[model samples]
Target chain A: MRKEDMVKLISAEGFEFVIDKDAAMVSQTINNMLTSPGSFAETQHGEVTFPEISTTILEKICKYFYWHLQFASGKETEFPIEPELTLELMMAANYLHT
Target chain B: MMGGICSRKREQLVIENGGCRGVSERFCKIASSKWLGNSFSRPIVDCQPGRGKCPSLMDLCIYKIREDIDKYSSFSILPRDISQQIFNELIHSRCLTDVSLKAFRDCALQDVFLGEYPGVKDSWMDFISSQGSSLLSVDISSSDVTDSGLALLKDCPNLQTFAFNYTDQLSEHGLKHISGLSNLTSLSFKKCDAITAEGMRAFSNLINLEKLDLERCSGIHGGFFHLKGLLKLKSLNIRCCKCVTDLDLKAISGITSLKELQAFSSNITDVGVSYLKGLHNLTMLNLEGCNITNACLESISALVALAVLNLNRCRLNDDGWEKFSGNKNLKVLSLGFSDITDACLVHLKDLTNLESLNLDSCGIGDEGLANLTGLTLLKTLELSDTEVASNGLRHLSGLTNLENLNLSFTLVNDSSLKKLSGLTSLKSLNLDARQITDAGLAALTSLTGLTHLDLFGARISDSGTKCLQYFKNLQSLEICGGGLTDAGVKNIKDLASLTLLNLSQNCNLTDKTLELASGLTALVSLNVSNSCITREGLQYLKPLKNLRSLSLESCKVTASDIKNLQSDALPNLISFRPE
Candidate 1:
């Protein structure tokens, strides 16, 4: 949720943007819970780690989320900004839902 | 003029917290002593700047009034931000019609959107320029816009949806500008006559475009650019693109992504259609007016995914229908105006999934109804203007899901009513212009969920009114014959939800019929045409505020009666014709 460090992944299709998250904690997949233990919760089980998600896709997804968050928050103001940024942000939102 | 400016600013003032301080200050500046002395109207505020002079008598007269703006400052009115927020919400959510858009554009630059957002003239240029880069959808259909002015959209790299209706106004240049929008996924350029094969080549650049509609753009020629490059394109409509030949269909073999293709009126023949065998994903194909021969069915049969096929007026015969029998996925088959015979229904026996079938004016007879029994999932069946009779309808009762049954013509008698009673799901039953009597309507009591029942041109008299009470969900009842009397119209008051009551050609109806019908507050469409409705009947309709389309045609009313109907707040009146 911190605004500065986050980034977003813009998909090939202009409609969707994705976010990188701790799949074990965010997703209910049991395989993710076992391999990515620390990513799921703050526990003593250090052997298990996050599974299924690769580092490259996660980085792209995280960057996409950050870009969209900035655009959504900046929508209201005295200055009317370009909507092209919003379209990408909207696409990113749709990707995250998937 | 000087004082008018201050009032304009005050009216434009935003409510901050509860005080109207901003408006008051602006008003006071224009109400200075020098200007206040020349004022024709009295001023109420006594406050004066700089001098030690006592408040003037003129100022006391203006501020003394209780209706002054100062009195409204005490209430917790809407905040300036919240009010602007509401205005923004309304602007975006409201459907701006063509007339409203014209009015908005024609307004003085300062007045346009200024009444809501003051001093917006400086930011207006930036607003339009930014729209090009950020906007996702642009609909400039039927406007006085040209291709040269489309540079406004060049910066919009993220544009995905664009709908243009040039009709006869578009030229090749306009299409070239559209081709530059490479990122578009959905594009509709319906009826743009200026578009041709060259304009189509422009679309070759839109590799990512998914849906394209060039419906009725007859000038477009050649199939130089296929959608094979557009790996994601799903729907393509070139309906009535006359110049496009059979060779153009060859390009479709490359587009594996095509799911729905509508080339209804194109010159596609059997040779050209064979190329569609590769389009295994095609679910819906409309070939309504194509000069297709019996040989075209051989190629069309290859599309296993074909579900809905519209071949109206395609000169298809029984042989063509035999080929389609194997298409189990065929659900909606429309063969309207085709020269198909009853023998063709033999081929339809294999299509068990078929639900909605239209054989209107296809010369089908009693033999066709027997083959239709195979379609167990059939819900809506249109047998209008066929050679079948009421006895044949008995076989259709087996269809449990049958909801809408249109037996508009072709010898439907009172006996057919017995067949429909078994159809529990039957809601909309059209027995229009059929030979059904009051006895047939009495059998309709079994259909409790009947909402829209059309017995137009049937032999049902005022006696049939008693049977209608059984239909709990009946909202619209049509009796287009000289049958219903004033008492029959009065009996309709029991049906509380009756919104549309059509008693056209019911010669007995007079001013009393209008009085009886007006009791139904939800009367949306009242058709008293070819009746004896006088000016008094028109006067009675004034209370039915919800009357939208009122047809008093062929009546003895004068032009003065029409003027009265026009004066009423007939908000939904789109068509009004007095007979």
Candidate 2:
């Protein structure tokens, strides 16, 4: 993919995950950050940092974004999650409005 | 490394507090300071206060509260905007149960739209009423909230808009609770049977009320007397309230501020319409299905501002057609199903501003259409079930702005369709007549902008399907005649925008038709009821993920075959036949 079509997401532990801008936009919060007319640091740099979300959870959210896109395009599949990660994942989902 | 460790420890402490108010406030300060440090170092990006570039403190608090909602007693400690967003999110995600709704008590939400939400009973009223004087608008339509539940809204004195449409549990006693809401500007109680003339006395105090819709309130006969004090009232809709007679019109005649009056299908006569002559500001008057005669038109002729008039099914004839010549501002006129014939249409020749004219089920023929040739601004013309034939269509060829034309059950045949070929703006054309053959369908190939084409009774054979290739924008196509075969289905399979396709009663269609149509993924409603398709063709519909309604009646496929498909591949299918 072209460099402008991708975005970088930094977790609480300073680990970075570079993903497609379209896939990362599955989160309404991130979509607003990138596209809102009032240009923010994230929109200018094409990178967003979450001080609350951990690295493991951020990676899982990236996977869910791609899975959501595939599912919406008529590909049916189940998204797996560990039982221990359920509460944190749901809290992050609520914050991101996924 | 030290700062990172400190931040993690603080985060753990915030989570351990179970989202208590004091700890969450400290967490917001720490998060904001960290972002401030980052912005100073970057220097190019200014994270200004109140810009909302970064997530606000309230967003984090709400996120924490949503994580464990059962731990908190109420969201009253948070700011009104935060609590309101949380309340709206809970309702939007369908996660707001009666137990979860308690957190929003006294949160001061300005609006609550819980229309048609299931399980909304009287017990939820306490949480809603706790918003108190801050509430502005509420729509609890179709809810089970009773008189006691409505009584709770009396505490919300600042309400400006209230709608309780189809709330059968509300009676005359329930309306008294909201009588003190003088700030109310718009109120609707549509289809509420309990609103009698006695209950409408509560409206006397709503001095600021501007729009009131009491449509289908069966017992509201003498209610207009109570609304005399409402000087700000602008629009009143009492359609289908059979008890409304000439006396109600006499009572409403004093309300000169009325601009729109919709009293269709009421017991009002010509004498009742005579009471409306003083209301010169009236812009829209719908007297459809009333007991009014030609004399009513004489009374309303002074209403020069009357832009829309519906006289369908009234006692109007060829006489007094001269009264309509004065209303030059009339843009929409519905005279369908009336006794007015070709002689009456000559008066409508001067209505050059008319954009939509409904002459359905009238006695208008070729001679009547000749008088309408000057109406070049006409966009929608309904000639369905009339005496209009091929020769009359020549007069309508100049109406290039016509987007909708209905010729269903008329004398329009193949020779008449060539006259419509120049109407390139036609977006919807209905030719549900037995006389329209394949030749007629071929003449309409130039109307490529057509999104809806209904030929339910036309004799469109397999050869006529070739003409449909030009209409790639067709979202709804109905050809219910028995002449369509599997070869015709191939021509329609590439119309990717088709959401509704009905090939029912065509017995020649088989499994090949279903196989060809499997590529139409946008189709939501598909009907092949009387076709020759069998159970083997049901597998071809698996790719249509958006298909919601599927009908396969009188075919070889059984109900079990459709049920299995619905359960496995087509989970979005809601309505299916053979059940």
Which candidate ranks first by lDDT, i.e. highest?
2
Span of ten consecutive residues with least summed lDDT in model 1 chain B: B106-115
**Displacement of the residue B405 alpha carbon in candidate 1, Å:** 0.7
Task: For residues B434-465, write the lDDT of model 2, one tens digit per residue.
Answer: 98999998988899999878887789999899
> Which candidate leads in DockQ?
2
Q: Candidate 2: TM-score? A: 0.80
Q: Supply candidate 2's per-residue lDDT for B222.
A: 87
Query: Tens digit of lDDT per residue, candidate 1, span B437-478?
Result: 788888878888877777766767877778888886776777
lDDT per residue, candidate 1, A1-98, as tens digits? 65222223222332322333332222223234334545544233322222333344434434433433443455321212122232232222232341
Task: Kindly report which residue stretches of model 1 are placed more than 4 angstroms away from their true locations once superposed.
Answer: A1-98, B1-129, B223-228
